[model samples]
Target: MAVAAAFTLPLVVPARAAAPAQAAEVAAKPGSPSPAFKTVGLRTQLNWMQAMPDTMPLAQMSIPGTHETMAFYGTAFAEAQEFKESPQKSLTMQLDAGIRALDIRVHPQGGVDGDRLHIWHGAADQKAELGSGVLGPLRDWLGKHPSETVLMNLSVEGTVDPSYCPGQDTASCMSGYFKEYVGPGKQYASLFWAPSVQGSSRAETPTLDKARGKVVLNVYRNSAGNPYSGWGLNYGTDAGYKAQVQDEYKVGTPSAITTKWNQVQAFLATTRTKRAGNLPYYNFLSGTGIPFLTPSDVAGGGSTGSGDPTDPPTYFTGVNERALGFLRTDSGERTGVMMMDYPGYGLIDEIIRHNPTSRAGTAVEQNGQLNAFVRASDGNLVRSYLPYDAQGTQGPWVQETVGATLKAPKMAGNPVATVRNDKTVDVFYRSDEGHLIEAWRPPGGTWQYADFSTSGYAPATIAGDPAVVNHNGVIRVFSRNPANNHLMESVLPTQGSTAGRWEKWDHADVTGAPQIFSSATAVVRQDKTVDVIYRTADNRVNHSYLAPGSSWKQELIPTEPPKGEGKLGEVAGDLSVVAQGSTISVFSRDAATNHLTESLLTGGVWVHTDVTAETNAPELSGSPVAALRSDNTLDVYYRSKDGHLIEAWLNSGSGTWQQFDFSNPVYHYAPPQIAGDPAIAIRPGKVSVFTQSGTGSHLTESWLTTSTWTNWDMTADNRAPVLG
Candidate 1:
């Protein structure tokens, strides 16, 4: 298809013998190394020729008005390690496999005057005899083949120039001659085109495709446009010349590269793809807390509260554990919570009280049922049986065997769940698709999991944050639905089977819109009726009752006093409802300030009270857990804004609030669940509270005994534990 030269370089070629005789003694000396080819005195000129297979037919192709050599050297000779060791002795030659010779006459001055380099391939030594100024033959040869390689030597014929000399003896003049050779096809052919007189520098392409690994052409330029030429070889063809320049040398990445040069530059861009992986990274701030723990610790501690002296408010102490999970029981047995500690990472060093001999289950996502507790076990705590269920039941929790371990789908973030118990224990969790799911350990049987909503009903929109409640014998799951601007709930059988049906109730009809509503908070009252309390968008506490079998009844827990108490009342988002007898009490931080507000259902109506007024108002979040104290009063615990757990309670059934200085302030106090609800039997009287600690390590619990708060402790199981 195309006409070009084929150059198969000789393994060891001898230079022209006659021209080197004058410097033969110098050449005979130990050849230090062949001098690297330079571009100072080199020049290039292209020519055309008829295609030929071998050197049996060659034509003389020399530039007109130029006596300089275009010494073509392959990358092999130029980059050979041996070239470095012996630059003076190494022979630099290009193959002439496809050049043919032509019979020509030689003049004394040795001038073959022509219009252009001849491009006619006939024999390796083909030449035409002509006097110094015959240009017609050269033009005829050029017309024949317009594309071919034509190299020549640079030097005067008979003697060296003297008058315009740059100061050189005979040695320099004698070493000026070089041989010319045409190249092969696109792959095995390349040239060292130098545009200079001193042979000091030049650009080169590899002789073979394999020799050139990945070529990246970066054309550096000033105001004159691209300064680098001969960059087309990087793209394997001339089609990429302009593209290669625009990509590497241009200011911005243009939408399209229009020229062959640019395409070549784009081809070269592959070379820069891997440089990003070679940079350094900072190692200091990446690990656990190396900086200050909190602002107060860094700024020299200052008092945060000005409550009373006998019962001063304190900040939360940090409580965290790892490799521990929370578990509950069917008899509602102390809502049995268990966890395991690896013991290596500050396990025994902290106030962790669980035995070291426990077998932990896997840490799975949305797998709140990984609950293994130290029940009334016949064996040691280490041998405590973990309850799982193959079928739904009300007692003796059994493991659900599945093809693979239960895990949250890949894209979900920190999938978690909490278990609540009535007749049977059920785990309520938010699925990866943002729908509530209930997996139950049926009484005396295996576990069964089901989606909370039916397909034909209203679509369920579950919030990532969810809470569950076991009321009387019914298990209720609560979640926020942003679609309809309301909190939603689904209920299940609380006494026997694990299967449950979800019933959706609009908060608007339940709480009445225009009156803002808070997120969902449900409590299984002592009377077995469900009391769901929440804050309206207007920051008022609203209550909805699912009384026995009756329809949902909604009412606003009035915070406005009987027109006498000069203080104003407000309700916050984290609403909590607890029923003690007919007096259902709702707790939440006041909207006006970070203070706790209590609404008591008295005389078939709700009444409001501020427990923080007697003591100083402490910051609180989430719903506070309430437990009937040994004194028959209500003790409430919650987290404050300063990141500490605090407690305040009614001293008596008469509604007189009193603050107590329990134990050290805990760092983070999640919504806590009281173990001794009036419905359960083995009532410890002592309030056990479960919450995630500030360290974010594991769940921790604190117990109140004999009117005093005790140190926090993690369970024996290693999975992260949570309270429902």
Candidate 2:
């Protein structure tokens, strides 16, 4: 219920989330960390996220974060953290105790340098600089322990420099100042997840693999509407990146402590029941109400039962004490992020305990097997499977051919493969006369083919290769229409009378979309929306999404109005769209430059990039094939101008474009003999591309093994029919 609930408050501290900082601002620093601080994480928890896989997200874990982390220097009412005199050092101690998120409020002095800024607990200046006092130490800690990631909930405290008061637009001003320490050659340049925050972060949540060794952001944007272009994940106000927070700081009086504690308990209960989502949850246990309840009164319990007979008694338990008791007594899972004032007295320990010690691997490994298909010179469809290899020897892959010899139909042009949701492998291609020829093989079943174009299933004909996707056992194949160049859809149902037929030719998505000049590329989004990307006759890239229970919506790339200078180049070759988690990427070739191009879709918007321009990759020939590795690496493979198969890859480690030319002669990996285009199938540790051999009628497969690329001729090795 994080983002699902309404964002009914302000964006910053003045609202419910940050208003607690404004409560009881009487200046007075607190004592050192509680006696319980030294008892937590004696040898463990220092690098807790280290044990978690990169695939795991902080949203899924229960983290302990400090509210007004550097607030220990201010007065008792203003302070949020413990260990005065050197609160920055206390930060290191908290990090050691499994505290991952920091609610850091900075008082911007409005200068070019970060040191001019100071940490503030409301109006009280904590006397801490933003640079060496805050980020500098965090950078050093992450550098030493690259596996551990820190989440900084950055915000503006009381006021900013008179020279640059952003007023309600503090998000922009804060991000602008942060730019000085990031980007090329800066100290904390690579300290944050660049890609996650690049576009509208609402598209998805940040996974640990993308956040480790850096400071993840929970930016407090005090503005109207969604803070789409700012830093960190939004509070799920208008989007789904929910950071549900409960910071009810106004504990009216010390006697009202139970009320404050109830908010903490309620937030935990609500978020835990709804914890199935992939959004970070915040539960603030720090609060103070000016004249009645101070910071100390709210966290460590205030005195009760008046000796002066005027009032008989005022009974309440400190929020932290209540939290420890409730969390210790209850065995509920997922406490989310426990943002606290004084996170000691075994409170931090209890919160950290909710995190999973070990999680099962979550990659979508397809039965640990690779499957591919190719067209033979005899026009027969040949399917290959790497099921523990031919002799099941040492993972060294071998081919198993199934085709015409087994009643598979003859086809024209290249054959494309699809792994349906039912785990069945199906390949489709066009007949010489543009008929729909489909071949399907069930798990451990014999190969089969049906000419749907003439079987009363589909009446339309395909002019080129097809893009196939199976959503929930419903197969949809989109191909260019031979007559008018419009992409046509042929559906195969898993049930009812249409189960065996490739029927349903007129899909609302295709019919509503404009005519396309090339084969359509389609991918199903995480939300089950089928997004088909194609190039119009005018050469501009376009997208059409089919959301359930709604009409098909089509628009040009970037957006309808096209906000920025960003635009997808004129596509000249076949487009390939791939869906990685919540991200959809369409790969194409720039018409004028023939450079491998990519248009990434996130937050319902597109951002274009020329791979050749970004990486200086050699100009590509024909079309490009793209596949995302099991390790989150995106690879774009294409035929280079020099007749070598080129691979351009992008991963977080390098954070840049890198390449490999298989036929460079230096790697000693022979190419597939300079083929037209390729089909890629990726499993756990390897990426395999099926291509047509230039010599003879061989269907060759090229794959990588550790440091070497291996190219094999399936036609010759398995005595299979020749490829066209």
Candidate 3:
């Protein structure tokens, strides 16, 4: 979020004691050997924010102006409210406290003849309390710490003497004064970090190695003649500053401050996700408000007099506390430059914790392997995967729920899984909050949850299960945007600085929920194109897909039946689509008759085909799932109405349908039972089907290899399984 480069009169009364003695121990004068200057063991262990040049304090180091010299003092103006925002410490102390940015507001102290520069806050002179001469100490500090950099933002805050530059104008006079103050033979000659400034529209972040022990000056308002005038860096304009002043006066309640903090958090999250990495992002965490005080109360001696001693502390304290909480929940994402008020009492440390480097090596590694993700009876996402022992022998399939305490009772349908380009497995599910939640395990890394709500594109409007497919390293997600019941697609970044950014597309306009069992399915074709199929709101099957360099186009799957077959009836449950070679087919169950229906995309048009014609096609009790075999043949699995498992396949050469009964009453300890939707996965030479028992108390698995069928109970009391 951009902060207006202007100052307003406000006081942050110190309601708490000073920070611990350790904070003061590192506070040493320039050129002194301080413990804070010591380099840590590793660069990764350091706070990334501290390494960036843009991190800074909100105001320049200044001493409080006394009531006698203060312009607004007396006459109902409380002296306690005058200089509370000014820093009591020197520049040396601020530098040691890990503050790399400095806000220096310079104005002409004497008349046109006077060459001295004095720092002022509004009408009050701060030269006495803060240092009178600022450049000397700042120059000395750079000489001592050659590895640290500081960003000095110089601006003209108050009125400047018109006679300083005669007809040259205020901009020229300010520019001339800055140059003479820090130019060659001046107070800071050969001290400023001039190379840090860029002349291009995009200013690159200076590397630490090049900017070590340097002072980067940013003049907010420079003359046209100045080489650094159009640095292209964003600076607060007069109009923006005026707007901010008006906003400050309008917000008078603590709740307004809370609302502003929420805006800041949202802005921070967006910046973290979309930042270009060329320049640092900054946020001013302070808000202007009088939550505890009103004009009537302040008029009745409530601020200065002890009549209203029971009033709460100033609004600044509340903002600071909220900022601290935001930083904690930010979870180590880079929070650019955070210009803050009262940046003491261990607040710098809290801000530094947001540096990404501080979180290096924190991601749990999952190692290379595919895992099955399913929702357990307890409403927790569970993972079931095969483990290998020391001798390379496969161990029993282990089942464990992820983040056991986190519940997903509102999860719709089954979680979908896909393998990323790096061979890591990602599982996507709808959370109870109607947001897309992803749990992924990187190769050699443990499982990690990528909550889309925080990672950028959060469509809380999602109404049903999401379908995910990874094509050529890009993970694409398709979900129904409940707002319009239109399908929405989001593509994950494949690589580079924008790697984690989720680029969302316009709604694909496929029918979404109100039908609880309806969901979309997607598959990647051989040419890296994507084919998606779903049940429309009219209970008709529709196909939408995207080819390379093309937009998504939709077409009806021709489910109207072949002339005399009558209507196929409504789609009962979720649709499944699979691609084999150049052929793409969709499978669904008829709502009215429970008859499994199939559609083949031939020559860009869908051709409805019946899987069972001569033989009796068992009525389906659940959605049908399809998988392509190694020989380019299709295998379909579904639960039968009699609570038995059935499979259908097509003859590779003749394109004829055949059925196989996997439920054997003699082999089972009890009568064979099946429930819910079945998931299919193809291995090297076999096809595996995972389903839940009729009682929904056990997870069963059936596989077909060669001509033999094997069945076993995988686990108990697990939801419908999703194979990766």
lDDT of each: 0.32, 0.61, 0.50
Write candidate 2's Cα lDDT for 1-724 as tens digits.
0000000111111100000011111212222233223233332345545434344567877888887787776566886665734756777777876788888777667444746566777778776777777888888778877767787776666545546644646556656666566545566667766644443343356766667788876664432223445456745554443337777778877667888888888888888667356677788888888877777678766566674788665445577767765654443446888887776735675576455322110011235565555555455565555556467554434444555576655554456556666666677777655677777777778677777777755545665566667655678777766455566777877889868566655543445666676666676755666777777766677787778667667876742226322445455556777665566767887654567766666555455666676677877655677766656677777766544667888754645667777767666454423546655666656766655543443556677766567877666777344544
lDDT tens digits, residue span 1-724, model 3: 0000010011211111111111112333321222211111111111122222221221211111111111212222212122322333244555655566665555665533324555654555555311334566666776765545666655555666666568877755665666555544655645665543332221334544345566665434332212234332333354422221111223355445556566556656655554333444445554333445332122111122243668543312244445544443332235656654434433454455343210000011134332556655444577777678888776467766673634333343357777766767777777645578877766777777766755556565465567887766788887766555566777887788878678776544333222222457888776666777777755677777778788767766654534322234456456777775455767887644557777765455455555544236677655677777655567787766555667787776665677866666775522265545566656546655666554323566665688666777666433233211
Backbone clashes under 3 angstroms, per model: 111, 13, 12
How many clashes in candidate 1? Answer: 111
lDDT at position 454, candidate 2 = 79
Measured with C-alpha atoms, the lDDT of residue 518 in candidate 1 is 38
lDDT of 1 by residue, 1-724 (tens): 0000010011111111110101111211111111111111111111111111111011111111111111112231111111212211111111011111111111121323221122111111112222112123233333342333332221122233353225755333222211111122222113323221122222332221111111111121111232222221222232342332222212111111122223322332332222122111100000011122221111111122465897664432111111111100000001001111001111111111110111111111112222332211111111112344676432332323220223311111012223344334444444435555554554456555565544412236454334456454455555556455466655556344545545555556655632323345565554456666666655566677777778677876554446312232544334555556555666776543546766666557445556676566555533354544434556576654433456776655444676643324352223221111111001234454444333322334444567564544343344323211
Sort by TM-score, top down from the best: 2, 3, 1
Model 3 has an lDDT value of 0.50
TM-score of 3: 0.46
TM-score of 2: 0.47
What ranges in model 3 sit over 4 Å off? 1-370, 405-412, 454-456, 495-499, 509-517, 560-569, 667-671, 716-724
Decide which is better by TM-score, 2 or 3.
2
| Worst 10-residue lDDT window, candidate 2 | 1-10
Residue 259 local lDDT, model 3: 65
| Candidate 1 vs 3: which has more lDDT | 3
